[model samples]
Target chain A: MNNDYYSKSYMPGIIKWGKITMLLGITLCFLPALVISFVYGYMPPAAAILTGLLSQVSVSGAFYIVEPISYFPILGIPGTYLTFLSGNTSNMRVPCSSVAQEAADVEFGTEQGSIISTIGIAVSVMVGLVILTVGAVGGNAIVGMMPAGMKEALNYLLPALFGAVFGQFAISRPKLAAVAAVIAIGMTWLLRNGFLDFMPGKNPPSYLVILIAVFGSIFAGRLIYKKELQVPEEEKTEAK
Target chain B: METGKKYLEMANSPLMWIAAGIAVFVVLMQSVIFFRKSLKAAPEVGLTKKQVKMAIQSSAISSIGPSIVILVTMISLLVTMGAPVSWMRLSFIGSVNYEAMAAGFGAQAMGTDLQHLTPIAFSCGLWTMILGSLGWLIFTLLFADKMNKVNHLLSKGNERMVPIISAGAMLGAFANLAAGNFFTETNSLTIGSAPSLACVFGCGIMMVLTKVAKTKNIQWLKEWSFAIAMFSGMFVGYLAR
Candidate 1:
C-alpha cells in the first residue's frame, strides 16, 4: 500500500524476471542463424560474414546505445526490457505505453506508470504476434489482392502516427512543444541541405539529431519552468 | 536465378521454420511472463482493475494500425527472407527497415543481392541481421536496471521534475521523427505532399478528438481516439497524394 513496497518489493521481482527473459531472448535470437549456417551446411565464409557485420554495424552501431538511453525516460525499466526484446520501439511500443498512461490518467515515471506501461507493452506484443502470424501464413495472397491505393496509403502511416503521438504530448505543454518543433524542423532542414554532410555517411547522424532535440527541449523546459519545478513537492501538490 | 531458387528452398525449409518458431516462442513467453507479473503487481501499485483493463484494451486497439502496416511490409520481406525468418525477425528485435537494410548489406558483402541470393549469401544475411542487433540486447541487459540513475540525475533529486523531463523527451523525439517525414530532400511543405498532410492531419484530428472526448464525457471516444486519428490522417494523406 505504501511507496516503499513498490520500490523495494515489486521492482526487484521485475528486474529479476526482466534479466532472465532478456537472456533467453538473446540466445533464441541466434537460433535461426545458427541452424541455417551449421545444420544446413550453408555457412558463409568467415571473411564474408565479417564484412557483412562490419557494413551493418557501421551504419547502425550508434543506434544500439543511443536509442536505449534516449528512450529510457519514457519506457522505464520493464518497458526497456520488453521493448528491446520485442522491437518496434518507436512505431509501436512507445505510443502504446504513452497512450496507456494517458487513458489511465497516470503520471509517467512513477511506479503506477511503470505497471500500466508494462501491461500496455505486453498486450501490444501479444497482439502484434497474432497479427504477424496470420500475415506470415497467408499475407502474400491478401496483399496481392489489395488495391494499389490502399497499399500506398500505408506508407503514410508512420508520419501520421508520429504526428498523433506528438499532439498527445504537446497539448499539455505548448511552450515546450513549440521549442521542440522549432529545433526539430531546423535540424531537419540543416540535415536535408548538406549542412551536416560532414558527419559519417555523408549526412547528419540521426542519433545526433535525436540527442539534440531531446536534450535541447529538456534544457528549455528546465529554464522555462524553473519556478514551478523548484517548489517543494508537498506544497506543489497542496496548491494544486 | 537458379541460385535464388535453391536459396529459397533452404530458407523455407522445415528446419528453418522450426528455428524461427522457437525464436517467436521466446518472445511470446517473455511477454506472457511479464504480463502476468505486472497484472499481479497492479493492485500493489494502486492501479484499479478497471484501469488495468482499460490500459490493455486501449493499447491493443492502438497497435492494430501499426501491426497491419507491419504485416503489409512483411509481405515484401517474405519474398526475400522466406516466411519464417520474416515472421521471426519482424516479431522480435528488429523493424522492417532495419532488417531489410541489414540483409541487403549482408548479401552485398557476399557479392550478391536480395534478388539473386545464393545459399551462402542468404546465410551471410542472417548472420549480419543477428549480429547487428546484438548490441541493443547487450546494452539493455547491462544497464536497464541501473537507468533509474539517469532519471535521478536529470531531475536533480527533485521528484516532481521527472514527469516534466519525460514529457519533454517525448515531445522532442516525436517531433524529430515527424519532422523527418514532413521534410524530404526534394520537398518542403509542398502542397499534396502525403507525409506532410499526414502529420498535419493526424495532429489536428487528435487535438479535436481530445477536446470533444473531454467536453462530451464520451469515454469510448477517448479510448478509440488514437486509431481514429491515425486512420483519418492516412486516408487524407492518400487522397491528397
Candidate 2:
C-alpha cells in the first residue's frame, strides 16, 4: 500500500504547477491596483508608496521569514502551498491537517500522512471559501443578527482554540509539553520586560521569542528522545 | 476619468469582478486539483473511504466557527472596499486583521482615510494589501520544495527524528501563540485576563474530555473534543467578563 510514486512522480508536478498557479494568482492579485491606477492616471507617489510599505513591512517583515519556517514541519509540502495561499494557517489548516492524520491513523512525515493532510486542508479551504462568500454576499445582516453576547464571545474563540490545540499535544506528551511551556513562558516574560530589546529593532522582539522557543523546544525534544528511545548502535546494526 | 462617486463605482465594477474572479478561480482550481489528487492517492496511503469521509466531515465542521469570525471581518471590509476586492483579498492570502490594516495604511499613504477613500486611495490601498502579503507567498513559492532539505538536515536522515522535530515545532509554535494570549501585559493600568481564562478553560475541558473518552470509549466525544473545549472556554470567558 506504500505509494512511493507520490513522492517520486506526482509531487514534482504538484510543486511545478503549484508555483505556476501561485505566481499567476499573485500577479492577478496585483492586477487590480495596476489597472485602477492606469485607468485613472492616479498612481501613488513613490515616497508615499515606500512609506506605506516600510511601515507595514517593518511590523510584519520578520513574520514573513519566521512563519514559513516555523510552520514548515507542520504543513509539509502540498499543505504549505495551499495553506499559505488560503492563509489562516495556525487556526485552520494546521488543525485540519492534524485531524486528518489522526483520523487516518497515519504518522506525520509519511506519504500517507501527507495525502490525508492535503485532503484535510483542501476541504477546510473550500469550506472556508464557501462560508466567506456567503457572508460577503449576504452582507452584514447575518452578522448583525448574531446575539450580542455571542459576538462578544468571539473574542475568546482564538485563545480557546490555541489552548485546545496545546492541550491536545500536551496530553499526548507531557514532558515535551513541559519543556515548551517553560521556554515560552520564560522567554515571553523576558521579552515583555524588554530584556531582549537591546538585540535589535522594536521594544519586545516578539519574533525572536517564538524562534527561540521553537528551536529550544525542538532541542529539548531531541534530547529527551535520544536519551529515552534511541536504540543502541550495535542493536541497530544487527537489526539492519 | 471617473472621479468622486463614479470612481467608487469602479471598485465593484464588472472589470474588477472579472479580475478578482480570475484570482479566486485559480485558488479554487488548486484546491480542487489537490483534493482530487489526494482522493485518488488515498487507497495507496491506507486511507479507507470511511476515514477520508470522517476526516472531511470533521474538518468541515470544525472550520465553521473560525470561518464565522473571518466572515464577520469580511463584512466590515466590504463596506469600504466593495465586494470584489474584499472578497478576493480575504479569499487569497489576506487574513481579516492584516487586510484591514493594509487597507488602512494604503488609504493613509494616499493622504486620506479608509472611510472617505478616493479612487487613488482605494487603488493604493489595494496595492498595499497585495504587497503586504507577498512575502509569505513568495517564500513558499521559492522554498516549499526546498524545505524538505530542512527536514532531512534536521533529522540527519533519521525517520524517527522527523516526527519528534515536527512535534517540537508544533508545540513550540502553538505555545508561543497561546502564551501571548495567556500572558498579556500585566501592570498597574489594566488587566487582560479574559483571554488567559479562556485558554485555561479550553485546556481544562480538553484534559477532562480526554479522560472521559478514554474511560467511556465515546467515539463522538473524542471527535468533538477540541470543538467542545473551545466553545466551552469561550462561554466561560464571556461569563468571566
Candidate 3:
C-alpha cells in the first residue's frame, strides 16, 4: 500500500536517541584536532586573545563558523566540498533523500515486513558511510594535483561570471543595464586606472567615483521610470 | 639526528588532519541539509533539477581553478628553487598563524639545543599547510559561485525578479576579495594600512543602492533586503574572521 498522508514523525525514543547520539558522536570526534594542535601549537591563549579583536566583518561564508581565518566568511565544509570535489564524497545526496522517503513511506504504525526491507536502511547507510570514507581519503590525492594560480591571470572569473548573469539584465532592461554597467564600470575603471594611481591597490574611497556612478544611474533610472519597476504579474498574485 | 627529528614530527600534532576531518564532516552535514532538493525536483526557487545539476557541476569545475593554482604554485615553487619538495616551506594564506607553528619549533629547538631545526618532514604543520591552501582556495571559489548563482537562479527562474537579487552577490564577492588585502596588510608592513574595509563596504553599498533606487519602490525594498542581508552575512563572517 502506498503511504500518502504526511504528518509528524512517530519514531520511537530509542530511534530518536540513536540519531542524537550519532550526531553527538560526530561532534565529539572533532576534539582530536584541538588536542593535537595544542601539542604542535594550537595556542588557545593566543587565539582567545586575538579572536576577540578580529572577529566579524568578513564577506565570505561567514555563516558556518564563529570565526574563520581572514574575516572573509568560510562556509565550513559543505561549501568546501562543493568547491573542491565536484560532488560530496558521501552520496549524501541520494541516501539522505532515501532516508527521508523511508520515513515518509513508513506507515505510522506499520513496518516494511520483509527482512531485506527491514534491514535495508541500516545496511545501506553502513555501506554508504564506508564508501564515503574511502572516497574522502582518495579524492584528496587527486585534487592535490589541480592548479590554483590560474585565478590571478584569470581574474575575470567574477566579471565573466557576472557578465553572463548581467547579460540578462542587458537583454531585459537594456537601457538600465547599460547605464548601471557604464557607471559602475567607468568609475571603477577611472578609479582603478585614473588619478587613483596616487593611492595603491587600485582602490579608491567610493564617496568620490563609484558612489557617483552607482547612485547616479539609480537616481537617473528612478526619474525616468517615476519610482515604479516593471514587476512580473505572477509575484503580484502571490503577494495578494 | 635532525632527519630523525623531522621524521617523528607527525606525533607532535595531528590537528591539521583533524581539522580537515572536522571540516569535511561539517560540510557533509550541511550538504545533507541544503541539497534537500525537491522530491520530483521540479524546481523550487526557480531552479530546474537540470539547471541545479549544471550549477553544481560548473561550481565544482570553477573551484578546481584555485585548487590547481595552490598545488602548482607549491610544486612550481619547489622546482623553480631547484630544491627538493622536502626542503620547501609553504606560506599558508589567510590564516597568518604560521608564526606560532614556528614558535613551537623554536621551543623544540631550544630543548634540542638548536642543534636540530629540522621539523618532521610529514608533520602536522606540513599537513596544515596543505589543508589551509586547499581550504582557502575551495572556500574562496564556492563562496563566489554561490553568490553568483543566486542571481543567475533568480534571473533564469524568473526574469523580472532578477534585479531584486541583483548587485548584492557581486558586491559581496568584491567585498571578500577586498578582505584579502586586509589580511595581507595585517601580515606585512608595520605602519598604517590603507582603509581597505571602508572601500569594500562603500563599493558594496554603492552596488546595492544603484540597483535599489532604480526599481519600483516595493521592488527596491526587496533588493535592498538582499544587500543588507549580504552585509549582515559579511558581518557574520568578519566576526568569525
Candidate 4:
C-alpha cells in the first residue's frame, strides 16, 4: 500500500532493456512516423518523432509530462521511460504544479520510485491512447475550422493562463512581487551583459541568466526579510 | 523517427492517464498507510497523523492565489497579444499530457512565437512577464511539493527572487544611447540593460527602504523599480527581433 515500492531504481532496471524494447517498437512507432514525414515532407518530424525516450531530459523539464503523454501514448513512452526511470515526474508538469497543489496533498516526496502500480497505470495508459488519437485526428480537423487569425491568436492562451498565475502571486504580496521583478530584471541584464562574457564559458551567458535571477532574488529575499526569522509552521512550510 | 513519433503519440495518449491515476492511487494509499503507521507507533494518539492532515489541508489551497495570479498574468498577456488558443490549451494540457514534449513554451511561447509567426514586430512585454510569472510560480510551488531534501530547481527560483529583492532599490541615473539593441529596432531610443541594472540594484535599495523608508514612501519605490524593469524587458524583447 505504501507505494514506496515504486522507487526510482525500477526505471533504470526497466531501462536496462529500453534500447531493445524501443528498437523493436521503433518499426511500429518511429518507422511509420518517418514514412509520414517523408510523404508530407514535414521536415524533421517536429521533434515529436525525432526524439524517443530521451524526451524527459531532452525537453525543458517541466511538470505534468505524465498527464499529457500518458493521455497521448506516442509522447508517453520516451519521456516516461527516461523520467520514470529516474523516478522523477517533475520534468513533465507545469513547472509550478506545487504552487497550486500542496506537497502533502500531492505526496511530493521526491524519493525515487519503482514500477509498483502497473495495473492502474496500464489501464490509464490505454485510455489515454484512445483519447489522444481521437483528439489529434478528429479534433484538429474540427478545431481547425476556425478563422485563421483567431487560430493564430489562440496561441496566446497559455501565456494568458500563466499571467493569471503571476497575477495571483502579485496579489499575495504586491510589494514583494514588485521588488522581485526589479531584481530579476537587473540580474537578467547583468548576466546578458559583458561581465559574464569576460569569464570563460561555452554556452554563453544566456543560459546562466535564470541562475543569476534566482540568486539575486534569493539574496534580496534574505536581506529584505532579515528581520522576520522564525520557524515556519509545517502547514506553511508545505505550502511553500 | 516513426518510432519517435509513435512514442510521442503513445506518450500523449489519454490512455496514459491510467498511469497517472495509478500513481495517484498508489501515493494516496501509501499516504494513508504511512499516516496510519505513524499513528499506531506514535508516542501520542494520532499527533503526527493529525499534523500531516493539517499540513495537507493548509498547504493544498494556499497556492490558489499566487498560482492563479501568475498563470492568469501569463495567459492574459498572451491573449492580448493574439496567440493561438491551441497554444493556450497546450500550455496546461501539454504538461498534463506530456509537457516534457511541449516543454514550458506552452507558457512562454506566446509572444515570441507569435512575433516570429507574423509580419508585425516582436513583443517582449508579455514574454518577460510570462517568464517571471512562471518562474515565480515554480519557486513558490517547489517549496510546497518537492520531497527531495535538497533543491534542484534553483535557477528558476532566482528569476522569481529578483523581483522581490528589488522592491526597494533606487534607480541609477543613465542616458539613453541605443541606436541598436535592447529596445527600438528603428527609433534609436533605448535605455536597454543600463536601466535594467538600475532597476534591480534599486530593488536592493528598496529592500533597505522597506523598513527604514517611511511606509508610504516605500510603496512608490517598489512601483517605480518594477515598472522600469518590466518596461525594459518589454523593450528589449519587442525590439530584439
Candidate 5:
C-alpha cells in the first residue's frame, strides 16, 4: 500500500512483459519478409536493403525518439507499452487515452490516470483490430459501396478529431491552452515558411517541430502556474 | 512475371496469414493482459469499476471513426502488398503514409515502383518496412521503463506539478497537430476557407457540448461530446469544400 509500491512492484513486471512482447512483435513483423525471400529464391541484395533503409530511416528515425518522449507525460507506463506496440500514437492513442482520463475524472500523471489510460488504450486497440479485420475480410466491397462525398468527409475527420481533443483539454485550462495553441501554430507557420529549416542540408522534420512545441508549452505552463498563483506551499501540494 | 505472381501468392498464402495471425494475436494478448492488470489495480488506485468500464466504453466508441480510416488504408495496401503483409504492417507501427512510403522506398531501392512489384523489389521493400519500425521498437523497449524519470525530473518531486506538466504536454502536442490541420496556405480566409474550418467547428461544438453537459448534468453528452464534435466538424469541412 505504500506510494511507490505500484512503481516498484507493478511497473517492473509490466516493463518485463513489455520488452518480451515488443521484441516478439518486432520479430513477427519480419516474418513476412523472411518468408517472401525464401519462397522467391531471391534474397534482396544487402545494398538494396540498405538503400531502402537509408531513404526511409533518415526521415522517420527521429520520430522514434521524439514521439516516445513527447508522448510519455500523457501516456504513462502501461499505456506507453501498449500504445507503442498497437501503433496510432497521435491520431488514436493520445486522444483515446486523454478522453478516458477525463471521463474517469482522474488527474493526469497519477496512478489512477495511468490505469484509466491503459484501459482506454487497450479497448481502442481491440476495437481498431476488429474494424481493420472487418475491412480486410470485406476488402473493396465495403469501401466501394460508400459514396464519394462521405469518403471525402472521412478524410477530413482527423483535423476535426484533433480540434475536439484540443478543445476537450483547453476548456479546463484556457490560458495554458491558448499558449499551447499559439506556440503550435506559430512554430508550424515558421516550419512552413522555412524559418526553422536551419539544418545544413536537411529540412527540419515535423516531429522536431512537435517536440519543440511540447517542451516550449511545458516551460510556459510551468511559468504561468508558478507566477500566476502565489499560494502557500501546502496549497500547491494538492496531489489528488 | 511468374515469379512476381508466385510471390504475391505466397505473400497471401496460409503460412503468411498464419504468421500475421500470430503476430496480431500477440498484440491482442498484450492489450488483454494490460487491461486485466489495470482492472486489478484500479481499486487500489482509487478508481471504481464503473469508472473503468465507462472509460473502456468511451474509448471504444472514440476508436470507431479513426479505425475506419485505418481500415480504408488497409484495403488500399492489401491490393498491392497482399493481405498478410498489409495486415501485419498496418497493425504494426507505421501509418498508411509511412507504410506506403517505406514500401515504395523498398521498391525504389531496386529501381522500381510498387505498381508491379517484382520478387526482389518486394523483398527489399519488406526489409525496408521491417527496418523502418525497429527504431521505435528498440527505443521503447530500452527506454520505456526509464521514462518515469521524465515525470520526476519535470515535477521536481512535487506531486501537484505532475498533472500540470502532463496537461501542458498533452495540450502542446495536440495543439501542434490541430494547428497544422486548421491553418494552411489559402488565398482568402472565410468560414469555409481552409481545413481550419474543421478545427473551428470541432472546438466550437465541444465547447457548446461541455457547457450543456455541465448545466444539464447530462453525463452521456459529456461522454459522446468528442464523437459529436468530430462528426460535426467533418460535416462542416465537407460542406465547406
Candidate 6:
C-alpha cells in the first residue's frame, strides 16, 4: 500500500504544485514593497534599508530554518507548503491540521494523514483570509465596540491554544507528554533567569528551548518505547 | 514633501491597495488550488467522502477563535501601518508579532519611529517587513521536498516510527509554547496569572471533553471540543483578572 501510494504519482504531482505556488508566493511578497518604493517614488536610503533588514534578520534568521524543520513532521509536504506561504503555522495551521486528522480518524505521518492535513490547512487559509478581509474593512469599529473584559481575554488566546492542543495530544501518550513538558518548562526557567544570556542579545534566542524540547523528547520517546515502536513484518503486511 | 499625515495618505492610496490586492489574491488562489487537489486525491488514500466533509467542517469551525485573535491584531496593525500594507502583510507570510517589530525596526533605522513617520521612513519600514519574511519562503523552497530524506533518516528505515516521531515533536513544540507563557519579563513565577491560569483551564477542559467524547461516542462534542475549551479558558482567565 505504501509503495502504491507513492508510485501512483499523487505525491510527486503535489510536490511540483507546491513548489510552483511557493515561487509565486515569493514573487508576490515583493509586490507592495516594489509598488510603494518605485511607483510612489519614495525609495528609502540604501543604508537605512540595510540597517532595517539586518535588525529584523538578527531576530528571525534562526527561525527561518528552525520552524520549517520542526513543523514538517506534523504538517507533511503539501501542508508545509500551504502553511509557510499562508503564515500562522502554530497558532492556526497546525491546530487545524491536528483536529482534521483526529476528526477523520487518520494516523499522523501517514499518506492519509497528509491528505487530511492538506485539506484542513487549505480550509484554514481560506477562512483566515476571509476573516482578515472583513476585519480590515470594519475592524476598527468592531474592536472599539468590544467589551474591555473580552479584549483582555484575547491576550490569553495563545497560551490557551497551546495548552488545549497539548492536552488534545497528551491524552494518547501521557508519559511522553510529561517528559516533554518538564524539559520545556525547565528551559523556560533557564531563559528567564538569564542563564542563557551567553548566547546572544539581552536574552538567548527562544528557538533554543524549542530545539532542545523537540529533540530531547524524541530521544526520550525512542529509549522508553523502543519495543512498542517496532512494527512486526506480518502486521505491516496485514495492514496493507 | 509633507511628512506625518501625508505618509499615511500614500500608504492608504489606491495604488497601494492594488498592490496589496495582488498579494492577497495569490494567497487565495493557492489555497483554493491546494484544497481542490487534496479533496480529489482523498479517495485514493482510502478516505471516505464523509470523512473529507467532516475534516473541512471541523477545520473551518476550529479556525474562528484564532481568526478573531488575528483580526484584533489586524486592527492594531492598520493603525500603525495603514490598511493596505496591514491587510497584505497579515494575509501573507506575516505574523502579528513579527510584522509590528519589523515595521518598527525599519522606521527606527531611518531615525524616526512609526508614529513620527516620513515618506522615506515608511518606505524603509516596508522594505524591512518584506525582507524579514523572505528567509522562510526561500528556505522552504529549497528544502521542503528534501525533508523527506531527513524524516527517513530519523526513523531509521522503520516506517512505523514516523508517527511516534511526529507526536513527540508536537508535544515538545506545544510544551515550549505553553510554558513560555508562564514567565514574563516582569514576573518570574506567574502560575496564577491570567494567561497561565487560562492555560491550566484550557488543558483541564480539554481533558474532560476528550474523555467524555470518547467514552460516550459523542461525535459532535469531539468536533467542537477545541473551541469550547479555548473560549471557556479565555472566559475563566478574564474573570480571574
The most accurate candidate by lDDT is 1
- List, residue by residue over A127-205, the lDDT tens digit for candidate 2: 9889888876777788889998888999889888888777766766678988998898778877877788887654567
> What's the i-RMS of each model?
1.3, 2.0, 14.6, 14.9, 1.9, 1.6
TM-score-better candidate, 1 vs 6? 1
- Cα error, candidate 6, residue B173 (Å): 1.0
Q: Kindly report the docking quality category of candidate 5.
A: medium
Writing each residue's lDDT as its tens digit, candidate 6 over A1-240 gives 244754377678777888888898888878878887898898998899999999888888878987887788888888888889888888999999998887777888888888999999999998999989988877589889889877888988778888888888787777888999999999988877878778874256676888898888878777766766665666543211
- Candidate 4 docking category? incorrect
Q: Model 2: clashing residue pairs?
A: none
TM-score of chain A of 4: 0.43
List DockQ for all candidates.
Answer: 0.75, 0.59, 0.05, 0.06, 0.67, 0.69
- Per-residue lDDT of B147-198 in model 2, one digit per residue for the tens? 9898888788877688778788888988888887656456111225888888
Please list all clashing residue pairs in model 6, or write none if there are none: none
Give the alpha carbon lDDT tens digit for every residue of A1-240 in model 4: 334322333333333343333232222222222322343233222232222222232333322221222111111222232223212122112212222112122222122101111211222222222333243334444444646543333332222222222332344345445555554445445544445665433323343443333344445555655433233444333212
Top TM-score prediction, candidate number:
1
If both were scored by lDDT, which would come out higher, candidate 5 or candidate 6?
6
**Best by the DockQ measure:** 1
Give the share of true interchain contacts found in each model: 0.76, 0.67, 0.00, 0.01, 0.75, 0.76
Measured with C-alpha atoms, the lDDT of residue B113 in candidate 6 is 88
lDDT of 1 by residue, A1-240 (tens): 566777787788888888998898888888888988888888888889888888887778877876787778877899999999999989999999988877776888888898899999999999999999988988688888889888999998888899898888777777888899999888887777767767775145666677788889888888877777877656554212
Provide the TM-score for each candidate, comma-separated: 0.95, 0.91, 0.38, 0.35, 0.93, 0.95
Output the worst ten-in-a-row residue range by lDDT, candidate 1 chain A: A231-240
**Comparing candidate 5 with candidate 6, which one achieves the higher TM-score?**
6
Query: Considering summed lDDT, which 10 consecutive residues are worst modelled in model 6 chain B?
Result: B180-189
* lDDT, candidate 3, A1-240, per-residue tens: 223211112122222332343343334333433443456553323332222212211111232221111111112212222222222211121112112212222211112211111122222223333333443334344335434432233232222222222332233344555566545545554554445546422134333443354335444444443323455555443211
* Candidate that beats the other on TM-score, 2 or 3, i.e. the better one: 2
lDDT of 1 at A21: 84
